[model samples]
Target: MPIHGNKMKKVFCYSLIFGILQLIPIRALGWGFKAHRQLNYAAVFTLPPELFKFYKPHINYITEKAVNADKRRYAFADEACRHFLDADHYEKKVPIDTIPNAWNNAVLKYSEDTLLAYGIVPWHLQRVQYQLTKAFAEKNLYLILKLSADLGHYAADLHVPLHSTENYNGQLTEQEGIHSLWESRLYELFEPNYDFFTGRASYLPNVSETIWERFAQSFAALDSVLIFEKLAGLKHPNKYSLQSNGRTNVKVYNEAFCIYYNHLLNGMIERRARASINLIGSLWYTAWVDAGQPDLSNLKEEPLKTENNDETLIQTLFQNSRIIGRKED
Candidate 1:
């Protein structure tokens, strides 16, 4: 939790980091994205093939909703929790304690939103699992896919630093590129090393503290992203230059960008990697738990039962999954 001044409380915010337009590689100013798709892809490979009996269907569900993020359907759907999700919900000028009951209600509402957005993954899984057991309810394909979509979106959101920040994409501070740097460029450079494979699920402990920690890390990183970039840009404006490779000329990632990013990001890469891996694993496990621990088999066959039925199911799942698309804050 932010150290609330005893005086009065005013601001509460969540980062909106996902919708950036471009990925700029200015050396160490952002993640080198050395890992790219490696870790997540590896996690998929590690899943027990037999689980594909279930996994394949979920993948199909998410794929179908892949465009929803762009369409802002999720954002609209998530508007229900806007108080907690929006960085603007809290006060910038005053203390939190000074706020009236109206603000308190806003904070409470926000708390619920935060819970749903960040922690809904496991719950979604659990719900599906329950339905699956209570009379072969797997046929509720729409519910399955829709809820899965929400989870995918939330998971992706968690990886984004700006998603956890009050300023989010930096619209609040005029530091817009910070969103892309945290998600896109970082994924582009260091994603390969992220250990998406965390084995099977485990019991979930109380996640309140965990979520708060995530917010803190992202909020903290925003300073470095903005400050270092500005400081570096001042001293070495052109220190970053792009180079042409055969296929496409990549930004040669300037020294200033690297130096500044490293200065700000520091251990965030490793911290994020560990969190990402465990989070994925935890979500999967929670889903299984929520699913009432149904045996991988014995569940009914695909609803449509087409040869490509798996494809359809896979397209239906979401909140977080493979970077089939753009980065989140």
Candidate 2:
């Protein structure tokens, strides 16, 4: 069968659009990469003199590699689950007290499969904190830096309201793309004025309890995150505008709509970002303290080699199965 001119043009256009969409990175899930780097960079100053002196020398690495966890989602099949926890998946109304704070207990009650099926951010955070503490104890400079960067990424993720819910991207509420609009787009526009000066980091006696508390706070805010966005959409029916990404035109929330949305939220993004900064710094400091306050100032800075074999294997498995934990995209 021979195709007509209009049909041929339609086919070509659709192919071009799909190609452009493929160029868009799949790692745009959690806090935007830009925001993650900024958060990690600002968190360094919150450390005490002992830790700050050591971290200051390689602050660039800490900031730049903060998005490694997000990048790993493509290569590691289980990595996606560490970025979020769909609290509502557990029960109606999301009773924080009913959910076990400890991983072992939660796994016992809900089964590991069930827990991972939704997400395991809060529990995984404690695991990373332990790894960081062990790295500090061993004074393994490479692991310390790598684990610190990973820790910061997860800590920031925990503060996002969408990360605590099943409808993370608002796909369930007919407001798809709200995840990026709330965390990424708004920060791109208004981050310049956000106050990142979260005082000095503090020690955490119990990491598990502290993380669960943070989870609860984020879950509590999920309602407003959804409702206000709905209200904003009702107010501005023409909320999106076409913008070029150097390759093709894409729909994005307009600046005016973003400004209006931010107004409705009343600095909620700024507050959460500040809290993330504080939590990252505090977790780093706490890990150091728990490791008996290691003298990091004298550790040798050894260049770490990049290892991608495991990542390659995991990526192969992911492609074969085409299954992943909850994700924004």
Q: How many residue pairs clash in each candidate?
A: 64, 0
Q: Give one digit per residue, the lDDT tens place, for model 2 in 1-329.
A: 98789778656744553343344434236788889999999999999898899899889989978977876665567898898888898754545977898899999999999888888999999999999999999999989999999999999999998988888888888988898888889998999999999999999998888888888888998898899998988899899999998868998999888988899999999999999999999999999999999887788867564334334544454354332444345
Residue pairs whose backbone atoms clash in candidate 2 = none
Which one is best on TM-score? 2
Model 1, 76-140: lDDT tens digits are: 34322221232323433212232222333534665654554432222333333344334223434
lDDT, candidate 1, equals 0.42
Error of 2 at 20 (Å): 9.3
Residue 223, candidate 2: Cα error in Å is: 0.6
Q: Model 2, residue 35: what's the lDDT? A: 92
Model 2: worst 10 consecutive residues (lDDT sum): 19-28
Model 2 alpha-carbon miss at residue 106, Å: 0.2
**Scored by Cα lDDT, where does model 2 land?**
0.84
Off by over 4 Å in 1: 1-53, 56-84, 87-146, 171-174, 193-200, 207-209, 239-256, 301-329
- All candidates' TM-scores? 0.54, 0.87
